[model samples]
Target: MAVHTLSRRQIFGYGTAGAAALMLGTGAWSTDSAFAAPVLTGNPFSLGVASGDPLPDGVVLWTRLAPDPFAEDGKGGMPATPVRVQYEVAEDERFRHVVRRGSVIATPELAHSVHPEIHGLRPDRVYFYRFRAAGHLSPTGRTRTTPAAGSDPRELTFAFASCQAWQDGYYTAYEHMAAEDLDLVVHLGDYLYEYGVKTNKRGVTTDPKFHTETVGLARYRLQYGLYKAEAPLQQAHANFPWIMTFDDHEVENNWADEISENNESPETFMLRRAAGFQALYEHAPLRRTQLPKGPDVQMYRRLSYGRLADFTMLDTRQYRDDQPCGDGASANCAERLDPDRTLLGARQRDWVLKGFSRSPARWQILGNQAPMGQTDQDPGADTLVWLDPWDGYVAERNRLLAEAGTRGVRNLVVVTGDRHQNYAWDLKRDYADPGSPTVGSEFVGTSVTSGGDGADMTPQGEQFLAANPHMRFFNSQRGYVRVRVDRDRWTSDFRVLPYVTRPGAPVSTRASVVVEDGVPGVQV
Candidate 1:
């Protein structure tokens, strides 16, 4: 794994050396002991930068120029190089009248990733932005701010997606997302999977290394670099602002608070978790509000789109009870619905209810990582199989929905991901009773990749669709959903790509689910 040679013009010799030295100083260990001497050459934007968590008055921007991504041997240090990266925001395509301009230093200790939260802009307005490094201008990106508080927006269009596996396929879903008319994109976790394995090694147990994530700071930085390399993902980030939350795959599969279920001690897991959170903060274009407080990072936040919709993004992993393994025999089985079981902790639950009760927006959307529907394990099993989703926290889900009804919150929609399949269902008070009242509606998007080796749904897909009457559309395809929200109605077109293996593949509408503003559920 010799370092890629750099051309004279492309090279940043002294600058790279300085940054590498800074990195080495920050950490006790070398970045790359495995590769004798790490030659830094990859472009900073090889993994692109993105803006997210848009505010009416501003937007957060992010970028990392990893000249030597794997330099730290996983300790997350390199020589400190004071590399000045310039950024510009404009109202138009022309270079004239650039609204915003600034240069930020890319320190080697943070893997040269810059997280800049830009403010002082008009609300509900679109702006173009780009970055310059070492006399090189990266691709131009378009982003917008949310409407001012209390403003009456007639319509709000946003997209939610999750589960992007780098090796599975090309990010065609993001390409389609860029073409759509969206105000913002909500990413419900798995922004990047820790898994890295050769395609040939993928079998029943894919990624033989079992999700080789970048544990320390340097590895985390490289992981972000790998994801930014995907063109479609980069395009989507450049196209519109995003609201993001991480699912378990971002760190490790099914990792809960302190305990990892891997027999690791709480101290060991927390240290790793800290590194994961730090890397996430470093790479994402998130507001300082999202920054961690102490060892715990709170990702629960709210965003409103004028009077049209209010989006509540949650953290399902943090503050969650360990996934109930229920003994070794039923290790995969999430424990049966317990009244005391909770998904969102007591405080967050209160916050959600309070937000819903006070929301002036017509539509209240919950951007979440997992499904809200009751997924029965044995097809027609009367007993609901308690999975890691809302199903596991029955009492909590019921309370939330009941509160919505009690407070007269109309058109509650939950956008979800993580099952790696497309599903649309009418959220009900109870799945056991087919005639239960509809509490809300849900649109679950399939994975960008990572369910299987291009394998579509089979028995479980068929049975779940049949058993669950409210479930209208189900597909195991690899794609995303396009959502259009308005005062009168909200429409979701489930778009599926032919395959993710190739680039430039055309996408088709698999199904459409629409819900009138006054209606709590969908009309299919």
Candidate 2:
């Protein structure tokens, strides 16, 4: 295919030559092959720069050149050929103290996205990086390495967010998150919604592509292009490194493993899933190891921040059993009581158990997609719940919690996102018994923009809080959760916004909760 790239300025020129050799930065491979710099027009870095998966020694830097982000063809208005992208990391914002500089090719196969996983740097320090391509210099992004293994770090401040449906409202939450002092951002799924919208919340006409739901590679790519082009989202990604995973809407609503929510043909559904996975990997700042093999990608992993905390990110959707009784607020579902039903397939469940036993970290943080606590949806004696979450797989939840409690895992905390409502639940050894021991704590965050300017409290929210005494706090609002952790305690602030349908909404902390060391439940 002949490659072509369009720029806003419509100016076209050949790019300058880059490094003579290519280094993967992951310390994986090196080649003396001549770098080929293609002709790129205008500014290709329209999507901006981002970094993620920060390790003790290195991090992944990402950038894609798309002058025309919403091009119907889904090429980001770039030539079909690969473009050589050069990057420089400096000790300071200015290039005067440059540290690491290298080149990587942005290939059309991945929609001209570059994920350079560079290594060989000092641990637990700050660095600024930028990208160069087609005579254009991308924006500078700040990222830092985690503390060296076994080293005691003083504190870590980060934010966790999810469910940003572009058409529902503006990304005002992201703009606020970008300005906050944070070390990292953990995105627990629903990065993009698969549904179509006629217009976004910004009161602008959406491109024609937004009228149709995404079903293939091209449509998914187009969807990402539209969201990534937003300046607020881009700024958030640029401000701090992110650890990402996907939930239902990234593929389809409440989709189980190899099963579509609408029950589309198995073959057809898998193909669409493949496209979603491929597009997600192409746009995300993930390591090469997590590349999709057909419809499967190993997204769950463990990240350690010294001996203070160990984060075990879970993939709740891909490996989950289908929801019991068709996935709504079911009054009584015996199918969910099956002992063999699982949310995290056998391998993943075992991984989590083994990691818990072996990790030396004082805090066990489960970075999860959905609420792990049993939510009694009905205040009456007849229990009801939305069955897509852990509530659908009671056996797995019980077994997992049993192990944590039995083994005496200290400070077991689960930070969750998906329900669009903020909640603090005391994870009980058995939800059936109100007086059961509290094995862990679950903090479920509200959505970034979903539910469209939610209220401070809904009637249903009030009802649920009253019914479930184990649930300490509940709020229905639009915002993310900010967390600060130290050796002594864990604090979570439920940040809120009054409106997202309109722009320039101010943010405030609606509620703040803490769990002291050696505690397994929420405190005032």
Please name the candidate that would achieve the greatest TM-score relative to the true structure: 2
Candidate 2 lDDT for residue 398: 91
221-330 per-residue lDDT for model 2 (tens digits): 89998888889999999989999989988888888987889988666677788788878887888887776666778899998899988889999988888888988878
lDDT of 1 by residue, 62-114 (tens): 77665544443532233455465668989886657688887666655555666
Worst 10 residues of 1 by lDDT: 27-36
Model 1 CA deviation exceeding 4 Å by range: 1-42, 70-78, 200-213, 325-335, 384-386, 452-457
lDDT of each: 0.73, 0.85
Provide the lDDT at 182 for model 2: 95
TM-score, one value per model: 0.86, 0.94
Stretches off by above 4 angstroms in model 2 are: 1-29
Please state every model's RMSD to the true fold in angstroms: 8.6, 6.6
Candidate 1 residue-wise lDDT at 469: 77
